[model samples]
Target: MMNLILHGYWRSSCSWRVRIVLNFKGLSAEYVPVHLVRGGGEQYYAEQRRINPMAQVPTLVVDGRSISQSVAIMEFLEETFPEPAMLPRDPYQRAKVRQLVEIVNSGIQPLQNLSVLKRLNSEGWDSDRVQSWAADWIRKGLLAYQDEMDSVGAQYSAGDSITLADAALVPQLVNARRFNVEFEGLSRLVEVETRLMNHPAFASTRPELQPDMEK
Candidate 1:
């Protein structure tokens, strides 16, 4: 029996990230879906909120411990499992991968996360406000990616093979597209996204393929 319980939303990019890492690491775990929109989300429910005070989906309950934040979950898994490595072994190379993940997780994802959107709406903001928030991050993030990728980007973020960095990037790009963030000028990152999308690991774990995705 798997001892891990992953509380996640079907369309959440962070949830997708953790799912890919679990798959890549050959770990078996139970998936518990948290509806992020229904009844104002099960994440906010008393029982679920006790699991994570942040009231966010993608909270991993592992070894009788509650873990939140996707990046932390990924790093914890890497340290705990440490085989079929998602990050490079070299210190500098791993730093590069970490940098990429941070850009997406902290710099990009937070600005466009659902909680923030809900807060915005509660404050009387409209769809345009939400779109603007998403656009600002995705556009600037793509530009940053383009500049960085100009020299170091090979077939992937750090090299010719898949890494945790790629794991982080692909999901957020899905959000960017879902939010209609324009990427016509940032061709390199777009190309990278396309490449990652074709990779079976990412392609198969997407929200669209999930059992609980709403219509």
Candidate 2:
């Protein structure tokens, strides 16, 4: 029985991405809540910084070895528990899945994360302005995602099967809604998200259902 612990925040999209993979893979991890906003963000504390030098949520500690970043954690889970593979076996399909994952991970999430928003606030960006900024970037990224998906023309992000791309996309959609990003032009993403949300892995791991979720 390898010990697994997940340190994360309820509302973090990155954390949600990892949670989806963990649940989909039927892997259990003892969850430790790290409230990102309370107490000036607990992630900045020495304890969390030791586990993740980046002080980000969704740090997976497996047998005492810590791994940070949601994509890395998902990849680790996929590799370790390959029974329910999150990636396709075909090389081109795998690359396509990775490409979609990066659309959210690199292209969108970094711009709208809590730390970046907080930094914007410090620089005198009001809530409305910050949210507008976040929404614009999210829309840009998702539009690109949609363009890629249109080319693929599958049920999910990368393909018909639930790949790493679906895990990444669902959470970013949650954030997009939070920032009031309009979905009028993103019907494909909405349709895919609706389908994915019905799956047990996604439904069970939603932020609102988490023990640490705050209203």
Model 1 residue 133 lDDT score = 81
Each model's C-alpha lDDT? 0.84, 0.92
| Deviation (Å) of 26 in candidate 1 | 2.0
For candidate 2, give the lDDT of residue 82: 94
Candidate 2 Cα outliers beyond 4 Å, as residue runs: 150-153
User: Which candidate's lDDT is highest?
Assistant: 2
**Which candidate number has the best TM-score?**
2
Residue pairs clashing, model 1: none
Model 1 misses residue 121 by how many Å? Answer: 2.3
Judged by lDDT against the true structure, how good is candidate 2?
A: 0.92
Pull out the clashing pairs in model 2.
Answer: none
Per residue, candidate 2 scores C-alpha lDDT tens digits across 88-179 of 99998899889999999999999998889999999999999999999999999999999987355578887778999999999999999999
| All candidates: TM-score | 0.92, 0.97
Give the alpha carbon lDDT tens digit for every residue of 1-215 in model 1. Answer: 43888999889999999988988788867889999889967889998888888898788998788899888999998998988888899898899888888888888888888888878888998989878888888778867766655255578776887788888888888888888898788777777878887877777788988878888
